[model samples]
Target: MTTDAQAGPITLADVRAALADTDPSRTNAGALRKVLGRGSYATIQKHLDAIRAERAPAPPEAPGAVPAPPAEALHAIWGAAWAQAQVMTLARMERLSAERDTALALAAAQAQDVAGLAAEIDAQAAAAQDLADSQAQALAAAQGVALEATARADRQAQELAAARAEIERITAAAAQAAALAEREATIERQTLQAALERQIDKYTDLKAVVDHLKPMAG
Candidate 1:
């Protein structure tokens, strides 16, 4: 016959006992407080909150839907995406290099043609000085075109490298977010399970008390 006031702390058992002694017509916080003796309103509210959380229904899953993927599944998805991106990047680099090599080969061929024109100019300088001057202008233009092509190839390579770095940064951020979400879900599930267990124990103790009193009443 320990009173709630003398007890170390208010427990689910104390709350159940107070509810049992309260008048059915006056089943309210005030009535329960009277039965609980020195237990404060806050103590009664804490147990009530626990009961509500325990009895709360679980959220229903979508029909035909699978449960959320685990952390490893998320990691695998990220890895697959990363691998695919790398493949595409490598292919792009290869194509760019091929185009650069083709441009360099074309430039080399044009320079060989210019060298043949120069030899002809030297052989017929007095008779075709004007023609040799025109060929000189053509050679300069070809050289300019070749330099421009080389610059373009360099720019493309730089751009490709920047794009790859951006993709890697985004992938890492996504993986980190997924890991954090999984951890939070795990913590929430554990907390809910613990609350449910406490609720079950409270009800079991209340039922035992009712059974013990039944024999005496009979």
Candidate 2:
């Protein structure tokens, strides 16, 4: 009957009838609108306020004292307030959830960057170790070559010393043999001069005896 647009207007009797089965303490205007299916928010609120004013008790005789509304009107106000609070709370929860998702994405990206840097550091350390090993091997080979050269030099020095000693010994033996041959030649020349002087003296004595015998025979 309330949903009929051909009906003149929404009446207080219609609102009172709708409130009969519903608890105003736990419901909002939108849900009541669905049940009635006719009135706009302005029309519903005007009627709701009129009902609350009618239910409020008279002011007390005391000074500065206010009157309390009836239980039904109070519950209706609280119900509208509670509905607004629920809407605000849901919106805030949605914003907080979006911010949390963004933060999680940023943290994941930073972790990937850190992993890449660590890999680069490990590669550099491995390359440095390889270079050190190669240098050590080269130094060992150079030391081996230097040792062989030193040994060859020592052997050559020993051979040169031996050759010099042999040359000096041969020179000393040749000097001794030349001195002995000169002494034997001097002795043979003296013996030949003495034999020639004795032969001349014998010839002179034989000639004098023959001259004396020829003078006696004449």
Candidate 3:
């Protein structure tokens, strides 16, 4: 247990002074008990408590001079003021301690709130990153489709060029075949005319021979 010197108002030196002095406030209760040889320790403790209460914290010096009390009540008023001062001091200390604890608790709660906010920000950032990644993937797919479309268009252009070339080649062949047919028709007509002239010459020669033989018989 804590000693009275550590917890109470009076120090060891004060105890020694009280023991040496003849005054009531300075005198030791233990020695007084021996002198009286009658009261219990509990009685002594009660008297000590009274003295302590009388010596309690003081009030503010009454703000200024106000009204003076009657001489009969002066002593009572002074004692009452001293007792009030002691009570006020203890109350103010207790109040200040309570306020300090409240401030500390509030500070701790605010720190936790800050941590929660930071975690929320981190979660949001992760979600945003996921969204950004999805967007990037979609853009890449669109670009790939555009490239494929460009390649298909190029292939179609090449096919169209080849089709035009084939059409031109077929047209040239048709023209050449038409020209050859016209030349063959002209050659057939000339051969038929030469055969007709040879037949006509043979017929004229046979008629002349028959006429000469008849005139000689007559």
Best by lDDT: 1
CA deviation > 4 Å runs, candidate 2: 1-88, 167-218
Please rank every candidate by TM-score, starting with the best: 3, 2, 1
Candidate 3, after superposition: displacement of residue 96 in Å? Answer: 3.5
C-alpha RMSD by candidate, in order: 70.5, 24.1, 22.1
**By TM-score, is 2 or 3 better?**
3
Best by TM-score: 3
Error of 3 at 205 (Å): 9.0
Evaluation by TM-score, superior candidate among 1 and 3: 3
Clashing pairs in 3: 18-26, 56-86, 57-85, 57-86, 58-85
Evaluate all candidate structures by whole-model CA lDDT and list the values in order. Answer: 0.81, 0.76, 0.74
C-alpha RMSD of candidate 2: 24.1
lDDT of 1: 0.81
TM-scores, in order shown? 0.38, 0.43, 0.50
Q: lDDT tens digits, residues 152-216, model 2?
A: 88888888888778777777777766667667666666666666666666666677777878899
Please identify which of the two predictions, 2 or 3, would achieve the higher lDDT against the true structure. Answer: 2
